[model samples]
Target: MSGFITALFDPTMPFVRNAALAGFLSSILFGILGSVVTVKRIAGLAGAISHAVLGGIGMALFLSVRGIVPGLPPIVGALIFAVIAAALIGVVSLKAKQREDTVINAIWAIGMSLGVLFIAKTPGYADPMSYMFGNILLVGGRELVLLAILDLVAIALVLAFYPQIEASAFDEEFATTRGVPVQAVFLAILTVTAVAVVLLQTFVGIVMVIAMLTLPAGTAGYVARNLAGMMVGATVLSWLFSFAGLALSWELDLPTGALVVTIAGAAFLGVAAVRGLKALAKRAGRRAEGRVAGQEAGR
Candidate 1:
C-alpha cells in the first residue's frame, strides 16, 4: 500500500501530475471566461472559434510537411488562425448589423471546411483526431507552462477590464453612452474568447469546448445572486467537474473529453433542478401565507 501511494504521488509521475494540473487550470480559466460569454449571449461563439481551429491546425501541418517551420507546433498555428477568424467574425458582425449567431455559423463552416481541405491535402497527417477531440495524455511540460501563462494573462485581463466588460455585457448601449469603448471591449472579448477556446480545445476537443465554457458558468449563474459570486462559483464548479471527470474516465475507460462534458452536464441539470425546486417552494410558501391570512380575517 505504501509503495502504491508513493508511486501515485511521486514527483517523477510528471505526466499524470502535470496533466491533472493543466486540466484544473484550464477548467478555472474557461469557467471565468464562460461567465462573460454566457451573459453576453456569446456561448455559441466559443463553438465557432473552436471549430475554426481546424484552419490553424491544417496550416501548421502543411508548414511542417514543407519543413518551412520545423518546430512550430500545431497549437500555435491554431491560435493564430483562430484569433484571426474570431476577429473577422466580430468585425463583420459589428459592421453589418447581422445577428451574432449568423456570423458565427458562417465562420464555423468556412473555417472547418478550410481545415479539412488543408489536412486532406497534407501527407502523413494522422492525428487530426487529437484536435477534434482532446487527448489529455498528450499534455506535457510545455503545455503546463503554456497553461500557466495563459491563465495569468486571462486573469489579468479580466481584472483590468472588469468594469467595461461588465457594463458592456449588461448593456452595450448604456456602456457606450457612458463613454466606454464598446468596440474595443467587444474586440477584446472576442480575442479572449478565441484564446480561451483554443486552450480548452487542447483538453476537451473543439466540439466540447462550448460545454466547458458554458456549463459550469451556467450552473453558477443559476445559484449566484451577483456577477462576482457567479464567476467564483463557476470557477469552483469547473474545477470540480474536471477532477470528477478525470477520475471517472480513468476508472471507466471512457474518453476524457466525453467524461468531462458528462460531468458538466450532470452539474447543469442538478443546479437547474435545485433552482426549480426553490422557486416552487417559494411560491407555495407565499400561497400558504395568503390562505392563512384570509382564514384569520374570516374568523
Candidate 2:
C-alpha cells in the first residue's frame, strides 16, 4: 500500500500516469462499445474486425520502411483499415446474409496474411511480438489524446442513438416497424466497434483483444436490466480489471497486457461460477417446495 501510494504521486514516472489515463479512456470506450457488441450478439464479428486491423499495421510498417509515406503512423493506418474493413464486412453481411461467416472468415485469414507479408517485406527486423501480444507500458501522451477523442465520439453516438440501438438489438422486426433503420444502425455500430477494436489493440494486442471487449460486457449482462446498466457495469469492471492488472504486473514483473486480460478473465469466471451456484440453489429450492406441497396435499 505504501509503495502504491508513492508510485501514484511520483512525478518522474510519466509512464504510470499515462497508463492510468489510457486505462480510464479505454474503460469508457470498452464500456460503451463492448456493451453494443455483446448485446448485438456480434462477438465473433468483432473478433474478425479486431484481427483485421493487423493488415493496416503491416501496410503502415511496410510503407514507412520503404520510404513511401514514411511519416504515416501505423495506428493511423490501423484506423483507416479498421473502418474500411468494418464497412466492407457490414455490407457483405447485410447482402450475403447466409454466407456471412464464410465472408468474415475469409477476410480474417486474408488480413492476417497481409500483415505477415508486409512485415516480412519491410527492410529491418521488426518485432511483431509487440503487435501480437501488446504492451501498455508503451502507451504515450499522443495515444492518450486519441483515446480521449475516440471515447467522446463513442459516448456521443451511444447517447444520441440509445433508444434506437436498444430497440434494434432486442427486436429487429419491431425496430424496423417503428422505422428505426435497423440495418443502418447495425452498420454504424460495427463501424464504431471497429474503431474501438483498433484502439484497444494497443492495450491487449490482436490475439486476445476480443476478450477485453466481450468478457466485461458479457459479465455485466448477467445483472444489467438495460443497455445503460450494462454499459455502466462494464465500465466499472473494465476500470477495475485494467488497474488491478497493471498493479499486479508491476508488482510481479509480468507482461502488463496479458496480466490485464488474465485479471478480467478471472473476474468473468468468478461471476459465472457464482451465478451458476445461485441458479442451482434456486432450482433445489423449487424442488423442495414442490415436495412439501405434495406432502401437505396428501396429509
Candidate 3:
C-alpha cells in the first residue's frame, strides 16, 4: 500500500496515477449507468455486450497485423461491436417477437468464441487474459481521458433525461402511454451502456466488468429510495472498491481487476446477507407475536 502510494508520486510510474484516475472517473459511469441497468433489470443484456466486445477486440488485432485496417486500436473494434450488439438486443427486446435471452446468449457465446479464435490466429500469440482480466498498470493516459469524457457524458445524459429515464426504468409500458418514446429511450440507454462497457473493459476486463457494474448499484439498492439516490450511492461505493482494489492489489501483488471485482462482490454479498438476516428476524418476531395474540384471544 505504501509502495503504491509512493509510486503514485514517483513520476517514473505514471500508469499508477492513471489507474487511480481510471477508478475515479469510471465510478461515475458504474454508478449512473449501473443504477439504470439494475432498475431496468438489464444486467444480462449488459453482460452480453461486455463479453461480445472481445470479438471486436480480436478482430481489430487480427486486422491490424494483416494490414487490413492496419494500426486499428482494439478499443475501436470493441466500441463498434458493443454498440451493434446493444442495438440488436434492444431491437429484438423491443419487438418481443422472440425470446430475448436466446439472442443475448447467442451473442455472448459467439462474441467470446470469435475473440478466442481471432487471438489464436493472430500473427503471434495474443494473450486473451489481459482483455479478459485487465492489468491496471497498462491503463494509459488516453484511456483515463476517455473515462473522464464518458463520465461527463453519462452524467449529462442522465440529468437531461432524468424524468423520462426514471419513468421508463421503473415501468416502460407506463412511460410509453405517457408518450415518452419508450423504445427510443430504451435504445439510447443500451447504446450508452455499450459505450461504457467498452471503456470499463479496460478497467476490469470483459468478464469482471459486469460485476463492478451490478454490485455497487445492487448494494446501493439497500439504501437508495430512488434512481438518483442509487446513482449517487453506487458511484461512491464503486470508487471506494476501485481505489481499495488498486491499493491492496498493489500491496499484495495480486491481479488488480480481479481484486477489484472480488472487493465489490464481497461488499454486495455482505450487504445482502445482512439485509436477509434482518428480514428473517423480523418475520420470526411477527410470527411469535401472532401466536401470542392468538393464544390471548382464545383465553
The 0-to-1 C-alpha lDDT of every candidate, in the order given, reads: 0.80, 0.85, 0.90
Residue 69's lDDT in candidate 2: 90
lDDT of 3: 0.90
- TM-score, every prediction: 0.87, 0.94, 0.97
Model 3 per-residue lDDT tens digits across residues 1-299: 78989988889888888888888888999999999999999999999999999999999999999888889999899988998899889888988737899999999999999999999889977898889997767888888888888888998999899999999988888898999998888888898899899988965698667998899999999989889999999999999999999999889989989899999999999999999999999999999999999999999
Q: Please write out the lDDT profile of model 1 over residues 1-299, one tens digit for every residue.
A: 34433543788876656656877888767767889888988877778888989888888888888688876777898898888888877877688766666788988888888888878877784566767778775678777787788788878988888888899999999999999998898888888788878876866688568887889999989878967778889888888887777677766767877788888999899889988999999999999999999999999
The residue-by-residue lDDT of candidate 2 on 178-251, one tens digit each, is: 99999999988987788778887966688557877888898898999989999999999998888887787777
Which ranges in model 3 have alpha carbons more than 4 Å from their true place? Answer: none
**Using alpha carbons, what is the TM-score of model 1?**
0.87
* Poorest 10 consecutive residues by lDDT, candidate 2: 1-10
Q: Any idea what lDDT model 1 has?
A: 0.80
Estimate candidate 2's alpha-carbon lDDT, on a 0 to 1 scale.
0.85
Taking every candidate in turn, the Cα RMSD to the unseen true structure, in Å, is 2.9, 1.7, 1.2
Backbone atom clashes (below 3 Å) for every candidate? 0, 0, 0
* Model 3: lowest-lDDT 10 consecutive positions: 200-209
Where model 2 places Cα greater than 4 Å from the true spot, the runs are 295-299
